[model samples]
Target chain A: MTTTEARPSKLTPRGRATRERIIQAAAELIYEHGVQNTNNERIRLAAGVSGSQLTRHFPTKESLVRAVIAWRADTVIALHKIPQLGHLDTFASLRLWADSYIEREELCRGGCSYGSLAGEALKAAPSLRPDVADGFERWEDLFRAGLTAMRERGDLRPQADPDQLTHLLMAAFQGGMLLNQAADDVAPLRDALDAALAHVESFATHPVPHDDATGGEAP
Target chain B: MTTTEARPSKLTPRGRATRERIIQAAAELIYEHGVQNTNNERIRLAAGVSGSQLTRHFPTKESLVRAVIAWRADTVIALHKIPQLGHLDTFASLRLWADSYIEREELCRGGCSYGSLAGEALKAAPSLRPDVADGFERWEDLFRAGLTAMRERGDLRPQADPDQLTHLLMAAFQGGMLLNQAADDVAPLRDALDAALAHVESFATHPVPHDDATGGEAP
Candidate 1:
């Protein structure tokens, strides 16, 4: 009843399915109830897996949390992988990225998965810091790559600092999501993203002016 | 052993002190361990209170969490009450407020107390939403008041929207604190606040141009 017997690459189709189920259940539970409140027993019950099966996949809650972080990182990165959000070199695409999060808030009825992890559980669990930090760094890398593209395309001013802007965008995003969840409203998220985007947009060379009267699409 | 006989106004001096001690202990414990992991027994042990004494002040753990939310709000608001931060009519005072939070991060070694509460435990404890929400609203009001003062002074353009800017600033703050705590670095928080203040500065009527080279004092 240990992972030693069945490594991920060596697992049978059914074994892989079972492991995925358990990890998904654990992620949902941790995302909702938090890592500290969640237990192996509850995850087992929720996943409808036997004790041996649970132990075979993830013997410890810490291991399971680490898996959930990887799992959630995939889910989040996949959202950004969509063609529009993937490049994020254009104003419309950046708005799409913001909208995607607002859509997620409507579905999850909570904050960003990463924000929840970082704000409470990650700090409390020192051992999990690297995993969480890696996930966030990957998130920042995505935006950095996008901004780099914008700069190369002459869409952004030559003076714009992509590294600093990337970090600023991430901070605004994490902050926006936290406030949105706490207030159970989307306005805060929208305002934060809009302001951050405007800041980024300010650095555009030959910027297209936004219509002041209609509050038209960002240029 | 419940608070059946003693009320806040009617409490003797000793009773008040004991209650404050319990609340202060609970706040620290919750801030450190979160509401889910920190239980009644731990609170009692940490506060050095007997079961009867603990129960007399807070009959349930939920009540204690609510009290901690209120107490932390008071602590956070008190920091902003300093004359410079109370009315952020000038750019200098806003930087002071932002810097105060950065100084706090160096000391606290965690995210904003309110941000942590909202991200995890408060969401799990649905019954405590109103209390936590009210606490956040009060924090927003502080910023709103300051922004309103700026508008009244003709420092901000007539087009400036204080209410929307208030919400935006709060979102950036909570978000920035979160990233800073997670990365154990101050750069993200600094970037976020500087970006937010720059956004506000864009609204100044008779703008003072900052000396770009020296990183001179904010006007």
Candidate 2:
């Protein structure tokens, strides 16, 4: 694991709020335009921070990226416990997750924040890579656990590889997101996810019977 | 398809060669550093072009990216028909096709040039999306074509959905690449590929007879 260090900074209460504002702006920008394409000046302008104030909080772009990743990490960790994932319909579970992903993109038109950060940090900030690695694997674990539960219920093929399926699902999600950012329309994502979920459906050993109880929505 | 008009300026022989050199260098840099991260100055340095000369040829960062994508599209379209894809060991075929994907990543660290360019040009270059769409669909075509060939030889289950399997394989390949990029290693690729191939192997309905002269790869 790379030893990541946040740059030193001090902020008053109002300053801290301003700093948070800067990060929120940065997160939006970085997700859409990508971290490398965005400049500190732009970030300062977006956050309504003076030049001195921006540097006083985050001295480097990398630090700003780390803050976004940390904040995103909190969201992912909070909403995506294994048990919580287990309770939702696979389609609905995925759409809820897509909320953060889609909202972030519209906010900045950047690629994914964690993905963009990880790509930038790959060479520039090695310390941040482990956080990226750990974060991605955590999502993989959640998917694997959820799939395992479904399989135990005799929904999936006996030989279905949960870990592999997890990787496939995550890949399509991110790849679709990446393409959607490029294309600016959400159609690629819709196609990729629809295709992926359809593949998941086919792998079930037993045909998925239609639920007659409250068929329109999940309780 | 959106028309992204890059000013490919008319050049003398020397100027043409230099422009090609710059495009090649930018391709390599984008592969390593990502599309947005590699700047005109870095591009100039890498291509051994003076800053003035680089800007003379490519007025915008987007122009340089456009040229790189044009260059790579040639490389990406290298899928000459392989008549024996199914008969060959699955791993061998995958390895042969996987190189450009990896090299493509090195050129555009976070994405395929198709992915990156279409992303940037989605609104401006709708006409160009098909090229990007083709790249996305190519892997599935290969997998589907291979499975169809296998079926002709009575090697696949009669009920197997080659089209769906191709989509699944495509997702797995893309996903595995994402994991490989994040992990900064090839092992995940190997592991993930192995697992997917195993799933494909399970669909083998007929054992290869020893009498076939070219079928020794599978046990």
Candidate 3:
């Protein structure tokens, strides 16, 4: 069946539970071992589901991968929406947001959920590029929403473009994570976020004082 | 056999030619299909080499992957070293370097050579992480060397850190390419590079006139 036709919303309560279990198992396996290595049999064993159940929920590997992408996107979106971290309208809040990502040991170690998936998807599953793209768009919108709020509040200069700034931050984040994954260090990520933040800060209507403790210089 | 022992330098002229052919074929396949999908048999077939020849050159997949990583790194380094693009000491030259990458249709469409390899290497070939890390370090040094020149010339502010700025630029380039691949568009890459260049420009001792035509605003 097509991914659309197999939507979880159409399933019964028990079926939905089974599907969630399968997706959770697959997501964990994919994150640990990547999409190519995580096969149906392993996922079946991990989820404690029978072969029939997996096929019933996700008839194709592509469908399962799409679910995992959606799952990762949801998890990231939820994390970003945490009350203290959601607001990006203020410079302090933005810095805090950047710090929150840098401080996530799991993210530093495992790489970004979307970024890891994007690489695999782009290489092996080109059809899913749009799904990954959608996830990024939603993620970007989260930042854009906050920056737009800053613009509306007169916190950002008239010439500053929130959309463009969001792209820069997203680039910093994705690129930094890739470097982190390669080098097995967090410094690249921190530097990237710092640079993007410094760029964002340069557009502030009333520039925030440089926090010497953070080691981020004024743009 | 270990990759070190199988070094191309140790081979005779014909053997070295054979090895180069295999690596060239594998690199093309890996870039097009990815590491997981490019198997030894396919590589042998594509390279027009017999099974024994392929096995002789690369006893294991990891060995072949390492060779491919080195090949891609050398190619990228050579491209960056083209006299016109090599110097990053000046603001104008830095902009040119960023533009050259953004204008490469193949990179935009197929994704970056190192970035694509980095993702697969980080996931499937943990043993090759150091190799990829070394490649990135070398790439970063290219930019760092130029920024250092700027610093030595008193063109950069005293407080500006060339090493950190190099990280930021690398982040923008890598992250922009990933976003470009996912979104199937070039604007994200352009926006990211523009933002990074603006950030780099911010550190200039005597600011270059903002090129209004490029749409990059002063930081």
Candidate 4:
């Protein structure tokens, strides 16, 4: 099933707004109620869209789920505006990025958007695993970019592998988010991020004399 | 709705087997299809139980869900019979425990059972959140016990607060599990566990002079 990209380009601006509204409402409903409990009919009612409108945007539940996955992934990546995420040249920027996620978790009182969908969708919607995996790949890319920048700038030691570290950081962050969701606290996330950041910090190159270069301290 | 404890004491061996079958079937079905996609009829069919028999054990879907949560929690904890978890007295035991989980993640081809359920059920089954949270607490207690053992043995430094480190380890493990689920690989889990174990190793105290005490190597 096609997602937003499948929409006809001949639509007016109002058409675009309505389509977005349906997706937004569906995302929130799915987020709160889960994919199985939330159906297209409920989405129609919640989105203030007619049956035709809902169908026009998402012809099937699979299509709608795919759209939600894409939409949520984009929203998550876009919201985390930081250097290492976008540039990834330092430990300080990585910490700032971690803080942003922790703060959002506090405000939202939910796990990662992609993760929530994934836990529900992976088994039930086997076809969409790649889409969810793609979302994660994109996230890893952000870290990879930052680490690459650090490597180029002579900040990271030669032994540090950005690709492996990127995977490690993403996994650590996802695991911490899961624990935080279960405990309804940020301690899990904080620890996981700290550990990951510290691992990355362990690779810092020391240019100064007799300097201890492990970036273990949280910025 | 009540859980397994609510069952009558007069049940024969056959009745007991049937009840266990129903829960086991429900857990597998839910694990593969999610709670929403798998229904009472499917569960009954899978368990080879009659409608009345299913209803006799779990009067409501919520009750069945609660039973599943309780059953799965016990099963997960019981299966991981390692140090700290089985016996948490040394860093070697912890490494062994980490290796066991990484292996299980590969065998199961899914994330941590508790973590997957927590993500999907936290919002959909808010009533069950505490049950899930309680499960995590039990897991954390295992870690805490291990850390406390290390401290008492003079393996850990005096500054290591088992409680805080317990929370950190749990969170890091959970985050890494989530990433592994998304990516369908063990690298994330390995990385996260390594990071956590290394951090824990950092807290080790050396009683012997001129000894390198950080138990950083994976067993």
The local lDDT score (0 to 100) that residue A96 gets in candidate 3 is 81
Candidate with the greatest lDDT versus the true structure = 3
- Reproduced native contacts, each prediction: 0.54, 0.22, 0.69, 0.57
How many pairs of residues collide in model 3?
0
lDDT string for model 2 (B63-91, tens) is 66666776765555444345533333343
Chain B, candidate 3: TM? 0.94
Give the whole-model CA lDDT for all candidates, comma-separated. 0.75, 0.58, 0.85, 0.75
**CAPRI-style docking class of model 2 based on DockQ:** acceptable
User: B7 in model 3: Cα distance from truth in Å?
Assistant: 3.2
lDDT of 3 by residue, B120-207 (tens): 8888867788999999999898899999999889988877788779989999889899899998988788888998988888888896
Tell me how candidate 4 scores on lDDT: 0.75
* Candidate 2 or 1, higher TM-score: 1
Fraction of native contacts, model 2: 0.22
What is the alpha-carbon RMSD of candidate 2 to the true structure? 6.6
* Docking quality category of candidate 4 according to DockQ thresholds: acceptable
TM-scores of all predicted structures: 0.91, 0.68, 0.95, 0.87
Instruction: Rate residue A138 of model 3 by lDDT.
Output: 91
Q: Pick the candidate with the highest TM-score.
A: 3
